[model samples]
Target: MLLTTVLIADFEKAGRATCQRLLQLEKKIKVVGEARCGLEAMTAAAKLKPRVLLLDPSGVEGEGVYLVSTILEKSPKTRIILLSERASDADILDALSQGALGYLAKPALASYLTKAVRAVAAGEAWVPRRMVGRLIDQLAPGQA
Candidate 1:
């Protein structure tokens, strides 16, 4: 199996460590870089060109949406996976609107996150099924 290179950008040491540990536990996933802030993430994303970027919004100093779009702009092929504790409809929708390919609510199970990373790396969206209908409703021309 081809390994999926993942760049984890979390502000706190513990957060980064936990994510790195979980990802390392997955044989097919390899963590290639770690960043503590938005600038570092952009730099790492540009240099490493990881297949997936796991970003924790709270860890990034500036606006999370900007980071998402900027990262996409810099690395067009990189699929961004947002990790956050905020599970509100608006938060998830906002991240998706800004070019994030996946959103895993904080406290997410390790198995689910691993699967999400693989799915997103393969060019698939990794949003929960429950959010699909609402997302469609919100994005549909007449509904929004």
Candidate 2:
């Protein structure tokens, strides 16, 4: 079986653990690398070109937007999924504007996260249902 290479860009141990556990449970998503900060995340993404990037907004010096934009600029094919606790309107707006394909709250549920990654890898946006309305209403069309 060919597993998708998923690179995790979360500074916290718990965030990494969550990705590790989910990949372990599913066995189809392999974590190829990890980064503790936004700069490292960009570097790793550029070098590894993983299929998915799990980003922790809080870990990136609150510069998730910049990191997402940079990665998409350098590695346009990489799918970015923001992993965070606070998905405030501002955060969501920023992420969407910067081309983030999805956002997942922390303490991520395994099934949902897996589905999200697949959706993103398939070139589909996967925002939480609760935030879909907000994205449509507030975010610019064709932003991502």
> Which candidate tops lDDT?
1
The TM-scores, one per candidate, come to 0.91, 0.87
- Full-model lDDT for every candidate: 0.87, 0.82
Please report the TM-score between candidate 2 and the true structure.
0.87
Model 2 Cα lDDT, one tens digit per residue, 1-144:
457788998889877887877876666778889988888888999999999998886866656677889888877889999988777867876887898888887755565888888778777988777777667666566653
* Per-residue lDDT over 1-144 for candidate 1, one digit per residue giving the tens place of the 0 to 100 score: 799999999887887888888888888999999999889999999999999999988866566766899998899899999887666777778889999999987688465888899899999998978888888887685573
Native-to-model Cα distance after best TM-score fit, residue 103 in candidate 2, in Å: 0.3
Model 1, CA-based lDDT: 0.87
In candidate 1, stretches whose alpha carbon ends up further than 4 angstroms from where it belongs are: 141-144
RMSD of each: 1.8, 3.1
